[model samples]
Target: MTRCDWAENADEVMTHYHDYEWGVPTKDERETFELMTLEMMQAGLSWQTILNKRQNFKAAFADFKVDQVALFDDADVDRLMHDAGIIRNRLKIKDTVYNAQQLVKWHAAGKTMNAYLWAFVDGRPVVNRYQTASEVPAQTALSQQVSKALKKAGFKFMGPTIVQSWLEALGILDDHLAKCTVNHLGKK
Candidate 1:
């Protein structure tokens, strides 16, 4: 069975992300930070844009290291504004840095972002049996709740749609097509 589902156009970037990483359990802080940052940047834009610019974003954002990104200043943001590799949106860029600071603060608060995020599913991926893309929702009550909580925590740029995708990417929610073998993340 094909390892995907579609909400609309199954563009190359989305397809690649679905096959290679979506729904894959990731425990790395850097990867989590990268995905969260990308999701925030993706607000009001297509995921394709973010995916295409991912390399540039990694280069510009110091490889998505929270500690490094938390150090970004106006100069760093200015440098990013001129770089064609990233979205160059002032608010989003600023939010990325702010989110990094929040991430670090959250870690110091006794839970790493990974723990705080993945804990929503109790450290296990929430399995879903979505058979087609049309069944996929842009947002959910869960995402709204998560979004509200993140916003309350001083993080920026996360909304329901963005949070839902991040949840899927983090493997907090499994969104594989019903026919896909990868749907289970290899859990027997």
Candidate 2:
């Protein structure tokens, strides 16, 4: 069966994610935050690696609840560091907590993380039709702008490359192959 460009292995988890989640536009705050967190965790790594550990990550990060994780203390960091199921990277784990707090801060500023992120795309998904993986961009001007804004908002581990990944995951950019169902170009 055909699938999105990123689902390389075609394993059960990857296939499920590709068909149901990948490139599907999501507006919920919690889901967006979780995808953002996982995308950051995916840095210098494979998506399948992160997908395999997503459950453990949800357990460790309290299901990506910004309210809950923003309150995480040193004890939380120490516990996550030793978790064998997840990536077990100290900096990445720490950034989850930091990013959660930053999300909270942005919330207080009358901005949803979704709102801040979707603003770059002007409140609509940037659909891209690529026949192959090589056609997709690793970074773009949009990602560069979002990366700078995220850093200014006190988020960590959110460079342009990471932001591009987030955009893809959040469906802010619909990077399905040209043949996928949602590939469309409106009157632009």
Candidate 3:
């Protein structure tokens, strides 16, 4: 029952996320897009805050549907800016829409976000064995590569640090502590 130290004193929602969702590989396009947006929204903020407003984000952004969100205009930006339930950062809100548009373009080109992202790790998760949370890096070379590629693909709010966090959340980069029970789960 040993969990990551970070999740030890977290609320029920965060605990559930840590135990069930975090570092769990996902190939679902919509889910991947949602996590990407959440990571971007988490820039300069805490993950707890983003998790607290996840439902609000889902509602505001059409459940992270790429096509739907890609169509969001200035009106939608204004609406999101005024939404009290979610983080009201204008830049993040606008970037979410922009990223959605990029996702749509990728989809139209016969490439899913899931496929494009997983390809970086060669379709497998990179499991890291760390004894402490401090051993985990904030960003890595792989994340920098991915961030550059994403930016070239017209994605917004995808800097290396944010991309690294997104990759970890997506299970592409498994950074669970060695003592954590879920650490072993990342291995095939």
> What tens digits encode model 3's per-residue C-alpha lDDT throughout 69-101?
999999999989999999899999999898888
Better TM-score candidate (2, 3): 3
Cα deviation at 150, candidate 2, in Å, is 1.1
Query: Pick by lDDT: which candidate is best?
Result: 3
Clashing pairs in 2: none
**Alpha-carbon local distance difference test for all models:** 0.83, 0.83, 0.89
Residue pairs clashing, model 3: none
Instruction: Report the number of clashing residue pairs per model.
Output: 1, 0, 0
lDDT of 1: 0.83
How does residue 106 of candidate 1 score in lDDT? 76
Worst 10 residues of 3 by lDDT: 179-188
Better of 1 and 3 by TM-score: 3
Q: Kindly list the per-residue Cα lDDT of model 2 for residues 31-51, writing each as its tens digit.
A: 988998898889889988999
Query: Per-residue CA lDDT of candidate 1, range 30-66, in tens?
Result: 9999999998888888888888888989999999989
Worst 10 residues of 2 by lDDT: 179-188
Better of 1 and 3 by lDDT: 3
Quote model 1's TM-score. 0.90
